[model samples]
Target: MEEQFYLVWPPVLLLLLSLGRRRRTLVLGLSTVVVAASAASWLSYRTPSGGSTPDVYFSPVLGVVPLATGCVLALLLDDERCRSFASGLAGHLGTWAGAAAVVGVQFWIGDDWTDHAWTFGLLMPATGLAAAVLIGGLVSVRTPVSVALSWSPVAWFGRRVSYSAYLWHPLVIALLGTFAIGWFGNVWLFAAAVIVSIGAAYAIEVPVEKLRARVREARRLVAEDHAARSAAAS
Candidate 1:
């Protein structure tokens, strides 16, 4: 939960990258440095009390690593060398292996091993890159999983509720915990969170979005009217 504020780092980095989009080499070099610094910080830094590494975990550097990796991967999509690397049987095997390694690392580390730098630094970014590649590849190929995800209802629900769910679910879980609702298992908790979040999001966001759309339309119409008047006057 403390890490929520640090989530801003990804978008901030993305904005910087967007600003420097024309300078691809410079952006790549900076991204590489940031990633390396993040990993190095994990490897070198330790808490004074030798407990969990919350400082490193919640640091802005670590927060940007995954999204930064994704951005780098996106940039590489146009590269002939990268395309060749991702096209063949070897590439397919590498993608699956990377995915498996991600899962295996999580299983090996278990839920209690939060202080490990190797997990945060090396494994996390690797897994994030692997996931981006795997998912991108799947969607590009239009696999059955991607097709189901693209279904109108599913896509609409995701577009509408995903951000709201991400924000609200933690609060919902915290509230449920505070209420001493011990009967709810993980699945029940997840179900409750989704239902409640979706309803709340629809109630809140739908009206706001409609208002925004109306505002944009009004502005457009006013601008067009002014332009027409100027043209007629001229």
Candidate 2:
């Protein structure tokens, strides 16, 4: 739970992102190193019976591959031929397979989590890869998956407050814990948390945005007044 374990990724990701468009080679090369180092670390990691390596446990190593993978994808997607190939026959089925794999992989992890070396080692990257594919499929113009995800209400709420929902869900669950939510169930607790988080996100978002707009308007007015005075004095 020590948050410092999460700190290494952001700076590296930012460094990759900060390079100008011309720094493709440097960014790609460094990203590849990150992915490799992360995998190596994961593979070589030795956890005690009850102890945890926060870095691997938090899956920062697993995250590196995806960050690098995304960069590779952005490069590939930029090519028209790659785009055409992605929309081709195999592409369609691959996305669907990826989505199914995401669901199936969870069961796999639950099946014999502790004993499986490969599964435990590769879990983060494999799962992240499947998830990236599912997200890719959902946004793809050629797939019905896109249509399903784009349903008005789902998309609207997701766009509006998904971040808020993520931020507030755990807090809501902790708050509700004192009530002994077993009366209804954990599912009820989760649902309540989501609702609270979304509402909180929306409430904060709308007011903060309005305030920002007002501040921008006030600045514009001040600039206009200064310009007008300068013209008159001239």
Top model by TM-score, which number?
1
Candidate 2 deviation (Cα RMSD): 5.1
Q: Tens digit of lDDT per residue, candidate 2, span 6-94?
A: 57645754676576543457456855654585567567565446533334554545545666656555655666676677766646766
The segments of candidate 2 whose C-alpha lies over 4 angstroms from its true place after superposition are 1-31, 44-55, 111-120, 173-184, 217-234
TM-score of 2: 0.67
Query: How big is the positional error of residue 41 in model 2, measured in Å on the Cα after superposition?
Result: 4.3
What residue pairs are clashing in model 1? none
Backbone clash total, candidate 1: 0
lDDT of 1 at 132: 72
Candidate 2 clashing pairs, residues 3+ apart or interchain:
none
At residue 155, what lDDT does model 2 achieve?
89
Go through the candidates in order and give the C-alpha RMSD of each one to the true structure. 5.0, 5.1
Tell how far residue 201 is off in model 1, in angstroms.
Answer: 1.8
Model 1 segments more than 4 A misplaced: 1-27, 44-53, 78-109, 178-184
By lDDT, who's the top model here?
Answer: 1
